[model samples]
Target: MTPHQAEQVSFDNTELDKFAAYRSDGATPDAPDILDLSNNELMLPPLPAVAESLHRSGLRVNLYPDPAARFLKANLARHFGAEPAETVVGPGSGGVLQQLLLVLAGRGDEVLYAWPGFDAYPLLVAVTGATGVPVPLTATGEHDLPELLGRVTSRTRAVILCSPHNPTGRRIPRDTLREFLAALPPRVAAIVDQAYMEFDEEEDPHDLGLIREYPNVVLLRTFSKAYGLAGLRVGYAFASAEIALRARKTVIPFSVTHSGEQAAVTSLAQGEELARRLAHVRRLRADLHADLGAQGLTPIPSSANFVWLPLGGESDRFAEAALRAGVLVRSYSGDGVRISVGTEEAHRRVLIAAKEFLSV
Candidate 1:
């Protein structure tokens, strides 16, 4: 008799295969000295207060963290002027988003997001057993809200909007976003991913009136980008109490480590430090933009901590040149490249690479 063949595994294998793991072209060992402008990480070290908190929390690593992340959640709630029940904390914004997707969508459900947006959006949506519907961004790297609104179907359970959109760094204007949210069907949830909101030119980053105005809107934020806690991996979301409760239930217990919680809470209290850091990053971004423009590369105006070069078919070439110049920048193959604002030295290397590439 023939050896028994194992039965085929169940679930959507095709869908899983179609999705790719999130990729970031960060520095490699071969280029140990390379200036990494690939990942949009804060170029500066963690805040002094946050560092102190981390050191204190490090001593308690043996103990399990609060599963509910109560302290962090409470701080986040107070910061946003929302009740504790309205906030859900997770390992990072990506982790929080995953929980949200699990709670709001499932097999045969559709999740809509802009293309060339956050690299993780599609992957997370796929993991939830939901179909990921991507709407292409406009030529100027702005979300085509009309196209997005038009694509909505009855099966569309959630829409993910990235302000100061990843890669492109284009923000949807407040009025435009308000109109879009108002027009969206009340049954469909809207997730505004604001990981880079702090870097935006807005005076008040902690404002949460949008949630009150639109019950279906959920705001996602991360300490990784602005707070320089990428290593600790802390993020949170604010939404209606009902939605937050569901999302909170889906979070993996103790996913937000004790150190992360303590650090994030401490970081939240350092508003002046945060403002200074934001101002510095904005200055660097502006300088980088001017340098790129002077080199004849018209990078899109960015409110976030990175710049987008819509190289179209030549994106890989520019990335390659940057790498050769000992600078690591993110490339989207045929679409564009995103270079994070880094130190003056890193920006100098990027500028040299840009000049060389443009000349060729």
Candidate 2:
């Protein structure tokens, strides 16, 4: 094509036109008194030790971060009982996922995931020039694994499963996941996104030996959730050496900052603090679930830091009610509402909204 034709054609049908950009609660403005629980971020601040480490690392602004982020990879591998060669660190789990998608898929390839899952999945797949196939969630808000499997085709390059799934908060049982992986064609990669894994008490995230049986499995995680390091944007994954090597090649050079890396390393060592935070979050999550239940809203039992109300068409209405009551919540229109567990006061505000919503 001629230069003018190329420019016109590209402008007329931009790659971005195929998908919607991700929008998070953090990006929108909030009122001063609003108790924002829409983002599902940890309510607690960083551990004191982690903060101190980040402070010390901040002085190295002029120097670039380790392109390989070897320090973080080593610590993460040690903490999880994996080898450094199997670890892939990136700006965040999403970034790590991008790296994986870049290496694993491209035009004519299909990457499948549950619909109403992480909003970023489609955008990320589109960036890789791959088609994103979304399987609708069961009416009960859980993954329909059989349906997902049926959608797989020869062109399918990957399947992403988000445990303690976003929005719905439903976690796939370990045995069930193993079965799914076993049934999946080995040629297709299985990405298990455990971003909220730390918030779960039933499943041990350290079951790091999963990659042994399934060479195609990639266990992805992020420090942004339970670690309260959302701003730092540190995330990593454990995979076979072959997958890790290719994913690392796709990493944006020096994307992982020095401060972020050190904070992650320091955070891993703060077991006591981490445990305490988890306990507190679990308490808050339980209370929020109960309070919402008492208000006549059936909140699905959540394994993450948030609770989901499968309100269907009432979703937007519920979110608006929460906003009016000085609380922020995420509403997946025509689907449900996901409200993060927050301070008792923020939660109380949520309960008030729930009560009002129910009475209406």
RMSD of 2: 2.1
Candidate 1 clashes: the total is 0
Tens digits of per-residue lDDT, candidate 2, 311-355, equal 999999999888988888988899999998889999988988888
Candidate 1 lDDT, tens digit per residue, 1-360?
434555655675455567666764334526579888888999998888877888899999999999999998988888878899899899899999999999999988899999988878888998988889999999999999999999999999999999989989999998899999989999999999999998888625768889999999999989999999899989999999999999998999989999999999999899898889999999999999998999999999998999999999999999989988889998888899999999999999998899889988
User: What's the lDDT for residue 36 in model 1?
Assistant: 83
Residue pairs whose backbone atoms clash in candidate 2: none
User: Which has the greatest TM-score?
Assistant: 1
Kindly report which residue stretches of model 2 are placed more than 4 angstroms away from their true locations once superposed: 1-15, 24-27
Model 2: residue 196 alpha-carbon error in angstroms: 0.4
lDDT of every model, 2 decimals: 0.90, 0.90
